[model samples]
Target: GDDAKAAQRVVRQWLAKKGITAPHLVMENGSGLSRAERVSAREMAGMLQAAWRSPYSAEFISSMPIAGTDGTMRKRLKTTAMRGEAHIKTGTLNTVRAIAGYSRDINGNTWAVVAILNDKAPFGASSVLDQVLLDLYRQPKLPETASVL
Candidate 1:
């Protein structure tokens, strides 16, 4: 947590030095575990838009999940239509289970998706979230941000 805090401060300073005006950006924790934290859906969308505008978009996209290989998405999406096709980050807490990622449709349209599930116990957490992702991949496009979780 300290590392993330320090990094956030340092980044904000660097961005300021570069003449970029940004928000306070209260990332309670880089991993989003703090209970009092608030993240606007609009800001998340803007981040995705910014990523698209970055010069290294190709590198960013390619570095994403390869389905069965690395990162939090490694165990999942083994042999499905999403194999080596999506990169998502999963978060879990007492009352939280969330995932956000990018998926490119067959038509080559890339969509960024975020899904969150809360106010529930861990009784069947893993299976429940797995089903969420399966449904999303099964559907046409990664539905809107609030569609599948």
Candidate 2:
């Protein structure tokens, strides 16, 4: 109980400092794996974007699972063009599945992506999330055009 209280306090302070005002955010014990913990996909994406802009961005991104390379993503997107283009973090629960991370597109632009599924049957959610990343990686390259006067 005490640990949970302490965690809540610390998390609340961090959220306030970060100005994250997600109305539905709940950090139960700050473990991020609790059924009571809640955050919207928009909020998760915002956080990832913030991490990308932070001074420690390199270290933060390095800690994530690279698609088709390591961590939970070692076997994911292995045969697809998305492989090695995304650095993602995945979450799983009986009724919840989520992914949040950055993906570098074919045009060299980086994008933050997040997907969360809360359903009675979340079995196929990962496929949808993987598709999101794949689509990002497969974006068509921008056409080169002459500069206007």
User: What are the RMSD figures for all models against the true structure?
Assistant: 5.4, 5.6
Over the stretch 1-149, how does candidate 2's per-residue lDDT look in tens digits? 88888877886677667776677788776678777788898777767766776899999999999999999999999999888988999999899888888888887778888888889999888898898787767774433531111
For model 1, what is the alpha-carbon lDDT of residue 16?
60
**Pairs of residues at least 3 apart in sequence or in different chains that clash in candidate 2:** none
User: Model 2's lDDT to the true fold?
Assistant: 0.81
lDDT of 2 at 32: 88
Q: Write down the RMSD of candidate 1 (Cα, Å).
A: 5.4
lDDT of 1 by residue, 6-120 (tens): 9888867765664555473566665566786655544554455556567987787666665567877788777667666666667778887766666644444455665666766
- Candidate with top TM-score is 2
Worst 10 residues of 2 by lDDT: 140-149
